[model samples]
Target: MRVALGVSYNGQSYDGWQSQPSGRTVQDQLEKALGKFADQRISTLCAGRTDAGVHGLMQVVHFDTSAERAPYAWVRGTNSFLPRDIAVQWAHVVPDEFHCRASALSRRYAYSLLESPVRPSVDAGRVGWVFQPLDLAAMQAAATRLLGEHDFTSFRASACQALSPVKNLLRIEISRRGAYWRFEFEANAFLHHMIRNIMGCLIVIGQGKQAPEWIDEVLAARSRDAAAPTFSPDGLYFLGPRYDARWGLPDRTPAYDWLP
Candidate 1:
């Protein structure tokens, strides 16, 4: 049987989502806990792969297992062996055709940034910090140029294995609450380090370092060197993917509302 799970984690402790030789990844921990519970190996495929130090509010994954257990049981039993930073939020039985990644319509991510002079102490690894006050209008204008389908090679990582540099960026919402800025992104897909690179450009524009039209030049260049450096992964959060209503999967976890 195939089962789907909504998982959340603080990525500060893990290398990334994918399994590695060190076995310190979120996938490694979840699979190990799952193996302990089912008495057999259970491999999972996730909706999106996040980088190290990036958080996941509701990362969806599907795994096939011979273990016969109720959805709630799968959630409770699996989490029993998992670490405090990671847990299964919900579980559901899925059809054979359901895939965690390929079946998704779009994915969402958010970056929480702190605009202040002093460095962050309590929220050091939870938010990105900049000393200068950002111009929200400037950032918004620069972000507007990123909407729609385009070759995002300028912002893609050199190590990105994605077949194509083109992706349909559906939305980019920038809002500020107090001293914190929240940048929300929705897209059909994203290349490795795409959002982080774009964030660097936005921060530059917001700080009056460049004009809003600078993004257009970067896109036209289609070169990684043409864009700003990749921003820190500390502030990034995977908000999960959007599946069809027929899947009956939860769109979000409690952590969604808790994010700044």
Candidate 2:
């Protein structure tokens, strides 16, 4: 049987999502827990991979296992062996044809920022920080140029392994509440550091360092050198993949409520 699970993790302490030989990644920890619970080796494939210092709200994964257990049993059993920072939110018995990555219609991500003069203390390693007051209108104008499909080479990391730079950006919603700013993005797929790279440009533009038209120019250039540096991964979150309703999977977890 194949099982699909919704996972959430604080990526601050781990290397990243992929299992590493160092055995210090979210995947490594989760797989270890699963193995312990089932008393058999287990492996998983995820819908998306988040960078270090990044967080995940509803990262989906699937694994093939001969261990037969109730859905809730899998959830409670696996989580029992996991650490405090990583958790298996929910689980379901999925069809053999269901793949967490390929079955997704779209992926969503959120970036949280603190726009205050003081550096974060309690929320350290949880949000990106900008001391300058942002010009919301200018940033919104700049974001309009990125609404549709385009070759996002300018904003992609050089180490990105994605075959192509072209990606359909379904939406970009920026909003603010007090000293906190939230940027939500939906896309067919994302290149490595795509959102962080774009956030770098947007931050500069919002700070009045550049004009809104610069985003268009950068997109047209399709050169990595034309864009701003990649921003911090602290604030980035893999909001999760959107699957067809027929799958009957939950879109979000409790972690979503805690984020801005």
Q: Residue 242 lDDT in model 1?
A: 98
Each candidate structure's TM-score, on Cα atoms with residue i matched to residue i, is 0.99, 0.99
What C-alpha RMSD separates each model from the true structure? Answer: 0.6, 0.7
**Residue-pair clashes per candidate, as listed?**
0, 0
Tell me the spans in candidate 1 whose CA falls farther than 4 Å from its real position: none
lDDT of 2 at 96: 94
Across residues 68-142, which tens digit of lDDT does each residue of candidate 1 receive? 999999999999999999999999999999999999999999999999899888988999999998999999999
Off by over 4 Å in 2: none
Report the C-alpha lDDT of model 2 over 103-126, residue by residue, as the tens digit.
Answer: 999999999999999998899999
Worst 10 residues of 2 by lDDT: 251-260
Worst 10 residues of 1 by lDDT: 251-260
